[model samples]
Target: MSQFPPPLRQPEAERNPLPVPRPMSGRKVLLAVLAGLVLGWMIGMFMESIVANTPNDIDPDELHRLRWLLAAAGALSGLAIESIRQLQAASTDPAYRRRRRFRP
Candidate 1:
């Protein structure tokens, strides 16, 4: 027999490592939504400043409404991003993979 001992075997996790996706926690969701809303509101304000170069160019009340619209859009975007993340995580699951369809 040779002087060298048998080689050690790697554990199951090490042998076939699988990439795991972490679920978005509530805190992350809240932060994302808040960040989106704030950013959107800021953008709306910037746009308003640009459009309202002259006092009579844009109505003050309409600007307020515009801000709300932008904020809503931003919030929706945050939700969409989170949904995509969840979908990607689900797609990695064995069950989901089995049922998932491939595009031609």
Candidate 2:
């Protein structure tokens, strides 16, 4: 008796292909932005606290300003990073290359 059965090959239609990148949904986009904002806020608070003159703490007024400024900056950077990533993914796709090459 054979220890194992012969291996079976998958059909072309059933074979797995490389995953294609898709655009983020509205909810996913929101989550990405929110994650960036929170990350920036954390970093900003840490840096600000580190540089503070009195007892290593930031002033309340400065903290208020940092919240908005850092969050906005982070959101912009996050969106930009996502765009670059998407572009890279599209560039690597065969269909995208063909379409670009034969554009009218």
Candidate 3:
């Protein structure tokens, strides 16, 4: 008996993997954006409710300003999250050659 059985080769479909440089799927991107929006909205709503329930000693004008500030901050955070996702995708893209070509 041969010590080793005949090599079992995988089918061509299995040997070579699918396409490379896979871009971010639309479904995944949409889900990520939706999650970010929902989370930001929930946080904004929570802060607003807290400010509304605070004692009368709090300044009403300040509360209004706080809402604007929070809104901007939330938007920035969402953008940051999306940026990170894009960066990760770019890093894995096969077409993203690490070697740079210099032009005089």
Query: Which candidate should be chosen as best, given lDDT against the real structure?
Result: 1
Error of 3 at 11 (Å): 18
TM-score of each: 0.63, 0.50, 0.47
Better of 1 and 2 by TM-score: 1
Each candidate: what lDDT? 0.79, 0.71, 0.66
Best by TM-score: 1
What root-mean-square deviation over C-alphas does model 3 reach?
9.0
By lDDT, the better pick of 2 and 3 is 2
- The true-versus-predicted C-alpha distance at residue 72 of model 3, in Å, is 1.0
lDDT of 2 by residue, 16-67 (tens): 5656666645565566678888888887777667667467555678776886
What total of clashing residue pairs does each candidate reach? 0, 0, 0
Q: CA lDDT of 78 in candidate 1?
A: 83
Provide the lDDT at 93 for model 1: 60
**Model 3 lDDT vs. the true structure?**
0.66
Query: How big is the positional error of residue 24 in model 1, measured in Å on the Cα after superposition?
Result: 3.9
Q: Among all windows of ten consecutive residues in candidate 2, which has the lowest summed lDDT?
A: 92-101
List residue ranges in candidate 3 displaced over 4 A.
Answer: 1-42, 92-104
- In angstroms, the error of model 2 at 43 is 1.2
Pick by lDDT: 1 or 3, better one: 1
